[model samples]
Target: MSRLRFLAVPAAALLLLSACGDDDAGGTTSPATAAPTSPAPDAPGTTDASTGPATVALSDDGTHLVSAEGRSLYLFTSDQGTTSACGSGCLENWPPLVAA
Candidate 1:
């Protein structure tokens, strides 16, 4: 019973590691490929009101938002609404999204 329990732990860990590997190969996506190749249909350069300069794109899981240039958009939890809380030094690392 003790040997079975020890083996079970290793087996579970291996399964988790294998699952993580599949994300990079099968489930994971590069930022370049995630965005649209051409401009969206609504306007010449606009995607939508909510997303602003960003447009929605399809992924393995579902639809997600990306920048006009096809870069992935990430929201900062530290910010309040559309306002940015990050300082200039921090902005160097995480640039704020601005309207074009």
Candidate 2:
């Protein structure tokens, strides 16, 4: 519902924020998790599992992180420290990953 969407935005923002810090000024990105040797699963995730933690899996090439649905993930250079800069029109192209 509307409430979920509202909460999801902040959740997504926090995830984006964690992807960067003062140490990596060179713009290097760390994968949230180790890339699995296995191939990605067939589906994204169950909508009912809202309480579960959102997870990102590795794509087949092992070059980058991907959504459970297999969409390539990205971060904006405009974001500084623990803040997320992508919003509005930006989100239309790069939708944030929500826990549920």
Candidate 3:
């Protein structure tokens, strides 16, 4: 259990750290979690490939990623691990955030 905790803690911390931002004027900005890349056929769990990567920045509260047009992106708590459970049906109610 200790071994799992040791490894799990850092992994969780890294994910948490990636979402962190400084809330101040002239504060540093976190890099986009997903950078622009050519739509490749082999990539797993890829988003819409036809569109370009969305330019995201931390929200004013520095809690989450927002789109270039200033839309707050959210994740479904129901998503299993890294795989999104939200599908065609769920999108209508909780639309997935897509940006250019």
Candidate 4:
């Protein structure tokens, strides 16, 4: 009886820990709720399977490009045209507009 109880306690703890494991909270689309096969032709921007529709808007100051979702896109002056100078650490704060 004591040996059975010992095994059961650890098994219960393992189940609890597994339930608490980290989940991707970045709002990624799951297969169940994936984007539709075709976007509306009248939609304002281009749609991709992975990232959905993307559009460019002018920043409030009219200085930079903003996403349709209103996230600001920045360009590094240090980088030449169409190149990124940001490292992984910088990305944590300012995620890239394009998927890697």
- Give the number of the best model, judged by lDDT: 3
| Candidate 2 ranges beyond 4 A from true positions | 1-50
Ranking by lDDT: 3, 2, 4, 1
lDDT of 1 by residue, 1-100 (tens): 9999999999999999988774443354554323222322232333343453433343545356555454456766876654556676665665433432
Error of 1 at 83 (Å): 3.8
As a whole number from 0 to 100, the lDDT of residue 12 in candidate 4 is: 100
lDDT of each: 0.51, 0.59, 0.63, 0.54
Candidate 2: give the clashing pairs: none
lDDT at position 5, candidate 3: 94
TM-score, one value per model = 0.34, 0.44, 0.42, 0.36
Off by over 4 Å in 4: 1-53, 60-63, 80-83
RMSD of each: 10.3, 23.4, 15.8, 14.9
Per-residue lDDT tens digits for candidate 2, residues 1-100, read 9999999999999988887745533343434643332221123332433445557866666677887677987756887664557666566667666543
Regions of candidate 3 where Cα sits further than 4 Å from its true position: 1-48, 81-83, 98-100
- For candidate 1, list the clashing residue pairs, or say none: none
List model 4 lDDT by residue over 1-100, tens digit each.
9999999999999999989987644433212222233332222233443555345666555555666576876655765454456666665666555421
Q: Is candidate 2 or candidate 4 better by TM-score?
A: 2
What is the Å distance of residue 90 in model 2 from its true position?
Answer: 0.4
